[model samples]
Target: MKEIDFSKLIVTLVQPLVQEPSAITVTERDTERYREYVLDVAATDVGRVIGRQGHVASALRTVVEGARNKHINAKKIRLVINDHRH
Candidate 1:
């Protein structure tokens, strides 16, 4: 899978866990230097995606990083969980 696939994966993973699956948004940013991914969850369901003790978020980062390594495009990638649950 490619970068966009990761975004889709986030949606797929979080959709069933939340009441409003449509509220999930995965935003990607690319620059000459690096690519950044931000997972945005609904204010009401942030806890679901994050899980307990940040384990879910860490797992997400690990998966994306592993995928990037396999693709080996020589790019720096950052996966971020931007909690907009305020």
Candidate 2:
């Protein structure tokens, strides 16, 4: 299987769950110890992506962490969702 790009996948995962897909923006930053993915979405759609009780956000993080473990070594990756709708 062709390995997936977790950052891109993260963006794809969130785009559909949001109300304004065009407002969705993902930024990737790499550091010596970790890779950071910043997920930006409209405030109106923040609740939808985060889901009830944060289940959605947790799941998204889990998947990305899993993938990061498979590819990255001791280094790690993190997902940060930024909602600026309000």
Candidate 3:
């Protein structure tokens, strides 16, 4: 199986929804049971990314989860979104 560039995928998905594309950041972390992707967006753009009632976030997770299932055979994957605070 090919290695998935989850960080880049996440950035690509999130960039269009934010006011400052350059401020978006995606970090990956490995745990015992799951690989986590932490997506941090600008504080002002947090709501836009999250969407009303979390619909946008849910869709993002669904897509990433699908990619993991299709392209990788390893631990479960997680997507976490946060606001980058300065």
Say which candidate scores most in TM-score.
Answer: 3
Which candidate tops lDDT?
Answer: 3
Instruction: Name the runs in model 3 displaced over 4 angstroms.
Output: 84-86
RMSD of 1: 2.6
* TM-score (all chains, Cα) for each model: 0.75, 0.78, 0.89
| Model 2 poorest 10 in a row by lDDT | 68-77
Superposed model 1: Cα runs more than 4 Å off: 1-4, 31-33, 69-72
The pairs that clash in candidate 1 are none
Candidate-wise lDDT, in order: 0.76, 0.80, 0.87
On TM-score, who's better, 1 or 3?
3
Instruction: State, as a TM-score between 0 and 1, how close model 3 is to the true structure.
Output: 0.89
Could you arrange the candidates by TM-score from highest to lowest? 3, 2, 1
lDDT per residue as tens, model 3, 2-82: 777889999999998989999888888999988999998889999999899999999999998888854454787799998
Q: Candidate 1's residue-wise lDDT over 10-61, tens digit each?
A: 6777788788887788898987877787878778788877889989877877
TM-score of 1: 0.75
